[model samples]
Target: MTSSPLPSGHDVVVLGGGVAGCVLAARLSEDPRRSVCLVEAGPDYGPGQQGWPASLLNARALPRDDVWERHTAFYRIRARVLGGSSCVNGAWNTWGSNADHAEWTRAGGERWSAPALEPYRRRAVDRMRLRAAPDEELSAWASAALEAAGELGYPEVDMGAPGAPGRGRPLLNAVDGVRFNAALAYLDAQVRARPNLTVLSGALVDRLVVHGGRVRGVRVILDGRPSTLVADTHVLACGTYGSPAVLLRSGIGPEAHLRLNGIRCEVDLPGVGANLSDQPGVFVPRSPTPELDAALAAGEAAGNLYVSRMLVRAAGEYCPDGAWNLHLLPTAGPPLFGKLAPGRYEAGISAFLMKPVSRGHVRLRSADPCEPPVIEPAFLTDPDGRDAAVLRSGLRKAQQLADALAELAGPSDPVPAHTLSDADLRARVGTYWHPVGTCAMGPADEPGSVTDGQGAVYGVRGLRVADASVLPTVPAANTQLPVLAVAEMLADTLRA
Candidate 1:
């Protein structure tokens, strides 16, 4: 590794140009005096959506390109682009229940409260250009699903902010089938024109230079050359999987685990890679009638065929009052993974356990920064089997909705989802892609707390983590909008 000389280091160096990193770099650089640098491992398409690839810009389908690893486990799918997962996600945005905020407030303080964060949430919404799915965007199947939810007594509620559990359309960050990613939203031409803001693309962060309990600089491999970039403060916005792996590689995690990887331990933060929580669910396939298939195909030809436009937030047996634990999603479109004969479509309802108690971990395979981390989602592995039970309840609820839509689409399998054995359910489980809680926030004295309420690393000065990784608990809804709001709030804290 070669050390790069700098007469004066940057005011702040953000070590991942994902959603949060884009927000931090943009907001912090507002002051002309503060020089900020944002580093990303992937290519930056530059400026706007014009220069971006069609696959990444299309909001109708989730693109597999620009991801960290291809043909890997579904749960491990994470985007490796300048805009992070925002560049490849479903473009849906929904807020969690009040119970989620309550949990966050307990772990972090009043700042995590919904009321306290409302301004930032609104800021994120405006910046991301989030809008409700238009009526024209709804296919015949989505329209039928909405009617079915109403028949089941699920009242309509806005999915964009805090509210009671009900059925409604989620806000979308896409406009006219174009995905407006974080990079395009935050780093516009005007922002990129700022001389103080530097976006270093195709630079992989090797590790941080930690000494005397502070991060002096970060070592990165750029264009096959190792160099150190000094900064007065270092912020980790590497998302859940990448952030913890970076810390472990820098010898800032558990002593035993670091030693096992042949890396000397610096700070023994046992929680650095622990408490990995994510939402898991199962999709119950339904055979669409000829009429339904034709309608979906027509909608596709019209360029308005969205797989999932509406969802129902249903309370499970284990859910608390005024809160939901399951998301019943109705989808009808081309198969997400494989091809289907023309005019034939895949239709199903997925039951996702929103608030699961099962925990997982991310461990280092080796000291090499280029190697992928060992990620175990550990879904439905709670000792009391609560996650499995709740998921079953959700499945039963999904069956009810499907039954209501029997005229349009019928269950493919004779067996009901609720009747599936635990082993069978485990084999069929899929993720919602909302992973969090790896670098959880809490008091410095807490064993499982990697950062404090304001995102400062517990034992390391001049270092912080501001992303999905620091969220102590995964919210009950999709994580994209919440992550954007979190970055906005943390950027304010850094400014203060």
Candidate 2:
């Protein structure tokens, strides 16, 4: 809603001012010598939480406002605001197992290892002010879920770091029911006061001006006018969906696809918009007992009602030993989408298939920057049927937890989830909203590898990608914390 004249250029231009973008901008701009410009497609909301909308500031529920597309496919839903998905996510932060780090280390060498990234992870945790769920914040359902996991003989493990798979509460970025987004955490008043940092919001990136195997400049539509912002370095932090789309539009994607879209191919990278991976889950609803409903209503009235506060990190049949592939989340509160009757609420156990093998893609419909890219999650579509089988295993585990809480809630589904047909499972599947691997990191010779271990694009000089888009594989946990740590690590790489 506000407009300002664009500076001619900067030392570094961080595109997409989301979670990673904010962190990159904040860290890269720490040195007064480096002039860093952060461009976001959505509103900046200025400094602090006061200017943010009420829905975005509340951690009790995932806000639909400030998102890219409302009422769209759940998997396609992404935040368009400055803080990115953190502005609209569950505010829960969890870490992955050593196996996740092993997979990353394979693609990106030792830098992607657990021990190597630990320092940056700690920095992100402290900066974001992540804290464990307090006892007072847990509702009766969440409390029971934890008890049930222990009753089922699962050991308690820390959810915010690398450890064996088990049951525990995740670290939250919210405190006292208020969501602390990345913009608030990283782009604080002190960071914004830096004259070297320029945040340009409501600017939609059209394409990169690539020439001679290097980024010459970037064209963005700001204040209804098209302008070019030049920089010595261009960092793509536009996230999984937006990052790949920007590459394709810039004629840096698959040559065949670029030709079809009538865009001149500057780079023939085959992996630009491919290898999309995301976590998908199915919610098994339950009928809450009257007493449970009354208790939840009380929590709601007191403004302490949280949909979910705990989860079980369970290993699937195909999972490697000492690692988990499923998250059994038990939730009971106001429905995420629709409203329930006055005192009634929605209670369910959701089985999320973490680390899914099924890969999807993002493709440009045309060269138009305004046109939303075609996103195919391709959930449960692995050829070997491994993804679907793992999901079924998770569903059975969720049913076990639900059974443990039978006194508080009863099964509302006519049939158990594990027993459901493949078609039925596909129909009921929803995403964890953790999409990654569009501009994946790996060896340059690999077919689908877009970036190297250090996030430098295969053939592009003066360009790098520092976001979830570069993650070669999805970790077996929520992506918020991992992404923050990743951006921190990449910022260090840039600084060095």
Candidate 3:
């Protein structure tokens, strides 16, 4: 990695170097005429950080200085690198269907509807060469599972077409046996070639530089020095909790919430930190195959099936998308996972809800930039909610898929017994870690919406949010693809 001087000024200033921020910065700087500056809070990504090998992508394995462990009252979320979470995420590339988008729009997400964002969808997928089967052969488990779903009358939607549903193979951004983060795609030679783009790492933004109800720049602490960087336009891509925390520090949020924290309101966007959303997943470990055992022994890119059940509630009716996706991961050895003795392991099946109705919030804890934001996700807290119901459905689907593999392979194979119930299965699941919507984008009239359809902050001129935080609802797939689509849309809007 190389180092550079902080830009004195630029036409556009993007806060946070996550996937969305990086992609937008690169796209905005495509024109030699427009200068762009990006500020990242962590150290630059090193050589080993790139490429596959899930073990290396763990938050614990990343350099301590480069990874920030934000501690909230609940739990800690890791993110403190130039590429943001993408640098550490599993990088599963799954896209949602139009039906899924329509439901989001109907559920208070206006600009995020499927039809309205088709162009970005195409662009996001087209940007990379993603195939359903990169290993060139389907695992016996995957093959039997699809055939079982067909035999069981579960409509198989072709996941390749985001609008269609079927038992589809995992379409990954895992390129050449390596992990592809936003930093690689947006900040490679193309962005580097542009004299207009400047990236500064190890810069922790403290607050938005708001002046007379408008954003003028950002005040950050770089290397223990308090500095201010001004710009014509300011974009916050810091992420869900990060963006809201910064805004609250700068006095933008619900009036009561702000005043209680002793902050004078500059922008009373009540929804600034409301409507939090995320999709949590769980893992199912199979007995290891000889190949899987070998990969686990050698430390390679292990894959899995990331599947979700699509369900919606509106007008007292229920709609199921009847489609799901799975990521096939190739793993390192058992020594890394501790799941087995050196050779006693199996590939795993990771299943979760992609689009969940459970909502949460990101609020100021102590008005300290260093303090982690209060993240409260009321997961399954809503007993009468659809999020819980759909998650239950996902559990069933996951079990079905797992059961199908039993017939394809004998008891000696990877997959184990099918005696577990849905409840037993759900208890073993956790999160896929795609959190969004803390700063939802929609019309101002929408009570909990933060930014407008065009990615503009309500009541704050020259301020915009282009990241997963702006999503009104989590999509029915891995969020990296949708985050990229949102950035592509925002870039076009900025250019227009």
Candidate 4:
């Protein structure tokens, strides 16, 4: 985005234009007096309009980013568009559960509870204009998957219907074949028309300009030129990865680690990039049957059948009383709108291992803001072996579902759970990309918490975090709606 003549100084500055960042910025700028500046590391395509890349705007397909890498073979897919992962992800509105909120309340007080945050989730859904994909919209594969779920004793119900737990249709954040992301839903033309908000896309925030134990401004790199955008209050809404990396780069992390990374430690908060967690998932795919292929071909001709159905449940020992701990996303049709093959027919069940106890970390490779941070999301590395156990059960469940499909389609095949041992399952684990808890929240006395109940970074002044990085643990479901709720709560608490 071209630099405008907006004032350099502002009352509030929100960094990162992701889901939480977009909503937080838009919500905070409603004062009509608070001069808010939003900084993003990606391109701003204005709103949903033509000439924008079809890869990013296509709701039925997931776009890939070459820049988002990790320390392992598993790819970390994060969108670089203004709406962040909300733009690229399978725009499902799974609000998690009350048990999930109980954990949040335990870590960040009662305000983070589900009862307190349910209104925000509703408001967020209303703003995003989410709707449940109708049962008729289910593809042939999805229909058979649902049938298999019923055969396996799983309930056929709406996955996000509050306390009801079972497999059913998923609520999607899309409208008319387009993704209703945070940028379009919250920060649209009407919201951006407000004079108090100045959004600067393609601007990289290098570090926080901390002076006298308070953030004065941010050292930003815009269009390859360095500049500083001064503000009284600075909020880091840069999701799980970018948020903590910004803190570490600003010398607000573990002293020795920051020093080892060739940076001076301004604050010895050890939890800046610690306590990272993510949902590990795997895909068990099957070759499509002739009937499934024919049905898909018909849908392909008509541009219909965007099936986003799922099975949310507590498969094994992590079973809670009223909530699910795992998600089995069984989908049909081409992956990424024909990115895999021209007309290849396939079906896959994405098994998500939620309620994971494994924790990870994000370390800065160097002080350069452009250099990607060394992300170490140690998936399935739980010491208690519970994570692997849960994943094994979920994979077995997915294999059973796949087996049901194979039986209906006339090809009996074995997936990883049927063929490989539990030890093998450990080697081939991948994330659902729902990374959270890098900058966890807790009391100051605790060792791993970087923020308090109010998202105030411990020992910092006029600075706070308003993103998924502040979550104490990864929620039991998709992180989009939960992360948006976190931002809404922060916006309600943060001063003007």
Candidate 5:
């Protein structure tokens, strides 16, 4: 837990003290013999006590502090903190469906399937306190939305329960109105007290110190001072954006791109920063009634942190059964959201494409580690136009959800839905902020597989990527629960 100069060497060095890195650092340090060091780019509120930001403390809305730079068209929201985005994100916990992990089986065989992932899932679930809030916990607006959803045939049930279809109240990972982020969950008081584990904040890693095809250490800028950390094992949990950047700066990406960026190629892996995927979404906002506005505000003070109580899992008319897709959740919130800033108290349905076919890629803009690379999501670019079609249908679904609640949310003024053209929908869409798949995992020879089944880098030794970046495909869920499971599952292999 010391925040001073990091030890010169350790058994393991974990880059990015985000969700997965926190879990990895904690689990690996379990064995007293293993010395673990975790580096983070943001300040750590040591032991989650003093100096906690008000935005992070309030669960009513996710913290909107920008952690990374992004092109205006591709607004990639990331939380650069000790606990990562889990500290500031909407606390929606979902594991997607069994089908979500089926794609993983193609690369990692049964080891990556839902059944195989369950044990790790259980381990993660066991580690945290996650469950649906009491029905009475819902604000008046959320209550009305839930009832409206039920009337529209969406039932109340545990969406995370195995075989539980449709939607109910989303399970949250908050405790007593505060975010139960990675630091609080995995690096608890006892875990922090362990002498073998070291956590470093404000340490941004520039590149891996690689030699002889083996990763030896990391070159980091700790509090504006340059230093190198040597380790027996180096895990890149720098998240989708940061992790890939580390690889690229270390001369391990598309050879042509590396050369163009003035970085010498150490490993000409074409998939280092390719295959980026995220949930493309848009919010259908409306003016909130005076009653709902008061309730939304008052609920925050009463330990009712969220704007919504229930989520609607829709397969829509086009996709059903194992092919379940589309997520429509009613939102009632203040102007705290990053994209919805300076906004009035409003209520609306936030609909997103659950399994979009569109794909995107990330490319290095420069060899400098501090420079943000170009993130071209190319959202809604699928050839068949299915992605756009789904989002368009989602607008209709939101309109239906709103229509069911017209008696309550009947906006004092109208918003575009019926009048808005398909082109309008395309222009209004934003990110769900669940970016993943940059450092995708698969069989070594797979075209864009950056890591092997066990999360090992394809052409490197003593280095691996264990985070949202390694996901072979995007899970049609909130991703926090699943991402935690990935770290927990890999902890064992990493331990061995």
Candidate 6:
């Protein structure tokens, strides 16, 4: 691999041009004196590329779009584009609560607690437009589910207004009505126009160049051309799969696993790719109101109106470090009550069961960079059974909510005509696309940990990972905001 030297060894070379990489690069490059480079394996967005709505529907319809299509014991989807998964995912905007970070500090370390996260949260909010649902308007169908949940005695949260009847404001991470991608939000005209900042697409990074436990450069195969790029500080924002795999190819990862694959072990870090977790979620389909059915029949975006009226309700003290988010997204598809035809008009009440106690791991299948990694989610792997138990309970809660709404509106039967026994639910329960924690950040006291809270790789200078992969556990909400938050934090740390 041969190529030109960098204008000068960069201050930071961020791998992966996804949300985390983009945000970190943009923020780090804010000072004109510093240089940042973002490299992505996929093509950048263009007028020729499909729009957000089309991408969402395609993934929803084609099983291939879902990560579960891999059939590799774990379910995960990696976007091979400039914007990464955010470019093609359901453009739902949400943020993490103090409760979310507090749980991380508890499970991982105090450095990650809600208190430690306050400054990052402030910066994240400052970078975007945030709105909270009003008191009166918050009592919608989703809220009714939270109330019913409280009546059932599962933990809930009431931030302020009232205790018994839990209430929450729906926070969206949007700028105007358009979606807010880190690449878009962080890369203003100033950053985009910088000559020092090089955003390269189609640059497939094969491995990191490590010498004496420090990263010296990156190996890449760009557009079928062999090349090498050197940098002062290398950031592995390539994400969970890409980052860990790169490590393995470069003779890093678990000792035993590397030997089996005929590769020398450079870093005997067992936790290089372990403790994988994803929030369990099953679609709770809802039969549409007649008016809604008619609108959908006319080919309109059916569930959007209901989503606009959504609210999250909870009770009890916020877990701080436990499950803290309850997002109520309205999806138009087969009813949660039962399966429906393509012509059917329905909605899905998608919920993210954050604070999963379950954990899994990622391993290299072979030495080939073109081959995908072997992923074992070890879903429901926790001995406590807390994750599975909550999801089972949520399924029942969704059924109840559907029934209550059906009774009020009269839909023959609110539940799907298909009978989903407890057995079926247990068999079908899966994830809501929030996969994290393969490479976790923790204090030295924690075994098998990979990086520090600042995202710097332990024992390895000039190398860092800034993405969902660093999370020790999946949060109880969408990962978009948290990923962005960490990227921003990494930027500040790099600057300091």
Which has the greatest lDDT?
A: 2
**Would you estimate the TM-scores of all the predictions?**
0.98, 0.99, 0.81, 0.94, 0.93, 0.80
Can you write out model 1's per-residue Cα lDDT over 127-211, one digit (the tens) per residue?
Answer: 9999999999988888999999998999999999999888999999998999999999999999998878888888899999999
Off by over 4 Å in 5: 69-74, 290-305, 317-320, 336-344, 411-422
Preferred candidate (lDDT higher): 4 or 5: 5
- Give the residue spans of candidate 1 off by over 4 A: 1-8
lDDT tens digits, residue span 115-211, model 4: 7887887887788887887665677777777777888888766554466467776678876567677888777778888888888988887999776
Q: Give the TM-score of candidate 5.
A: 0.93
Look at candidate 2 and give me any clashing residue pairs: none
Per-candidate Cα RMSD to the true structure, in Å, reads: 2.2, 1.3, 5.4, 2.5, 2.7, 5.4
Give the alpha carbon lDDT tens digit for every residue of 1-496 in model 6.
0112333367778888887887787777778887777787876553222333444333223223423124444356667766666665544445555555665776556656666655776676566444443333222344554454455444444332112223244444433234454555565556678766877767888888788888888888786876777888888887766778887777777889999878877677777888787766566655566655554444334322233324343211224433343443434534434566655556545444556677777888887777788877666557865655555555554555555555322344455422455456546666666788887877766786887787777777888888888887665556766777777777777889
lDDT at residue 179 of model 6 (Cα atoms): 46
Task: Please estimate how well model 5 matches the true structure, expressed as its whole-model Cα lDDT.
Answer: 0.79
Q: What is the Cα root-mean-square deviation between model 1 and the actual structure?
A: 2.2
* Residue 257 lDDT in candidate 4: 92
Error of 4 at 103 (Å): 0.8
Instruction: State the local distance difference test value for candidate 6.
Output: 0.61
| Candidate 4, residue 185: how far the Cα is off, in Å | 0.8
lDDT for residue 6 in candidate 1, whole number 0-100: 29
Number of the top TM-score candidate = 2
Residues 293-344 of candidate 5: C-alpha lDDT, one tens digit per residue:
6676677667564677687777754564654577887877655344443324
Model 2 lDDT tens row, 108-169? 99999999999989999999999999998999999999999999988999999989878899
| Cα-based lDDT for every prediction | 0.92, 0.93, 0.65, 0.79, 0.79, 0.61
